[model samples]
Target: MASSPLGRPTRGTTGTNRLRRNDRWIAAADAFRRAADPLVVDLGYGASGVTAFELATRLQRVRADAEVRGLEIDPARVATATAQLEEVRAGATSFPADLRVSFARGGFEVPLPDGRRAAVIRAMNVLRQYDESDVAAAWRAMAARLAPDGLLVEGTCDEIGRVASWIDVDAAGAPQRFTLSLRLADLERPSIVAERLPKALIHRNVPGERVHALLVDLDREWDRAAALSTFGATQRFLAAVSALRDQGWAVQGGRSRWRLGELTLPWAAVSPLP
Candidate 1:
């Protein structure tokens, strides 16, 4: 018999559109868009498979042949997701019948048959229960299963999907970039993302840490740009992020992305201190 799945069971909390921000980010990713096979993995997709369905819908818009495989350590969760997928196929659910999605039992090892490697692995909210020290190993396990040009997006988001953050790791298991995405409407401050950071940096948000400094400066800029609030939260956020770049934060992405309340930077900008 096959050995057991390689990770712990998730809390299985999931909902419709809860990962919308993450889905859109993955859709825009070069790893998915340029992959020869474009096979994406939704690792530990919780108690429900809706996130995988939603991911396929969004990615399909970018690449018609995009496919998503929802993997879970719990065999019961896999059965549940498979049941839900049947509904989707039978046209009982809102998703398209032609949706190219499936569910399976697996974990950090990302067990794909026939020596297949994934183009992208999305592990949102899967590491919340893991100790920070376990992060690097988990990243390596998942990244090692990726295609040469693949990427691994690991991070967390709130239940309602308003606040989110993720780190992009290349196939070699090296983190390439970090991103924080928030819902700007009626937002308080961008630093709110500090709470939803990936496991690797969540504890590092204290003072004397790069993440801490980034949040502090981000909040400061948001406050400084308060005058622009009259133009709306979008414009205010744009101004705040632009000010951050001017301060030598090495911010990435342009106005179009900033308008969506996303801020990305090289991982070196916020990597925890040794």
Candidate 2:
């Protein structure tokens, strides 16, 4: 018998624009830009197909021929999302009638047609339910299906999309970088993204962990840049991230991304210690 789909069913909580930031990051990644086949999979798109639909809409901007396949283990969810395609075809929704998007029943075993590997496999919020020890195995399973330069973006976010963070895994199944993307408006502290850390790091936020220290320093820097808030959150965030860089953190993404409330750090910077 075939192995079961690799994840539990999520409540499928998602909203309009909920994943816009994630989509933006994917579009900017090298994997999406150079994919032999611009095939993006929205793995585990829950009960609501809106996120999958939205993902296709956003990715199409990067590659006009980009095709998105929303995969769900639950056949009911697949059926529901597939039905929504009719609305787009009929021009009932904002999506173009011919948008190259489809839905199917699948889980960690991506189930792409023709043994085609994806250039981007975004499993957002899919691994939150699995044990941390199970994460590496699941990642290996999914990453095995990527084209050479493909990416596996696996992370989580808050219900309303205010705070988000994800890990970028390479086709070799090695965790590469961790990124924190937030709304930044009325933000209390940059470390609030701790709540949305990837499953591997979420429970490892104790004092001795690298992630905890990062958060501690981020909160401190955010406080230090309080004066910059007079200039706006963007200015404050830039100063704060700059401070981290000065202190020797392998911070990635400059003003442009920071201004948008995103900060990326090398995987080693916050990887959980053995």
Candidate 3:
């Protein structure tokens, strides 16, 4: 399939495991597990296609036939990634022998062969450069490329992968959930994610916005739960997130997920102000 330009270029700053947190979430999501097509789109994968290759490898654990397509707006980035894929085939680089990952020069339009749409479009750290007003339109454009039951996982993370947050937008183009994934071992506070908020809620981190309120309360709870730090940071985080739900914070996920320093809440809780 030929790729057509549809989005802007990213700074192409990507590292070995910069997006591991986001990849884990996508791997465990229903979007990856239940897709009949099992095609994953790594939208705007920066300078290297390593992340997309990683996604394809990890996702194979869930769906053996899962294919990953790394899409980039820059032809040069695509060329570089394609060459890397060739090295993998040549056994010159460390990649799975049967990994099914391809490099395509496409944007949010998600060009794919045979009119196929992606089961999951993971656009991590790609929206940070866009104005907040451009977020919804960008989302809709990507959502439009999803299959009937496909998903759009879009968010941002810190340079070293300590902090991250994402939104789960469904096939119908409506956002359903917002998730905060932190590297508890390296995290200083729950509010550390404030700086990494998804484009939709970054600027809304003020007093009046719902997202501001969520973070403010979360930080307060994080401090209050410091007493539990004796048990471990994980316990402290669990207590804090449970407290948020107890106080009607609309938190999602259960203890199993919370144990990993993840707190999911309905998107309504942090949607940009109307």
Q: How accurate is candidate 3 locally (lDDT)?
A: 0.89
Model 2 CA deviation exceeding 4 Å by range: 1-4
lDDT of 3 by residue, 41-147 (tens): 99998999899888888899888999999999899999999999998888787788668999988887788888888999999999999998888888898999999
What alpha-carbon RMSD in Å does predicted model 2 have with respect to the real structure? 1.4
Compose the digit string of candidate 1's lDDT tens values, residues 63-151.
99999999999888989999999899899988999999988889999998788899999999999999999999999999999999999
State each model's CA lDDT, in order. Answer: 0.94, 0.89, 0.89
Backbone Cα, N, C clashes tallied per candidate: 1, 0, 0
lDDT of 2 by residue, 1-274 (tens): 1147766777777778788889899888889988889899999888778887888888888789888989888888888887888888999998888989998888888888888999999998888888999999999999999999899999998887889999999999999999999888789998889889999999999999999999999999999989998888888989999999999999998889998999999999999999
Better of 1 and 3 by TM-score: 1
Which whole-number lDDT from 0 to 100 does residue 168 have in model 3? 95
Which residue pairs show collisions in model 2?
Answer: none
RMSD score of candidate 1 (Å): 0.9
Candidate 2's TM-score = 0.97
TM-score of each: 0.99, 0.97, 0.97
Clashing pairs in 1: 12-47
Name the 10 consecutive residues with the lowest summed lDDT in model 3: 1-10
Count clashing pairs, candidate 3: 0
Which sequence of candidate numbers ranks them by lDDT, best first? 1, 2, 3
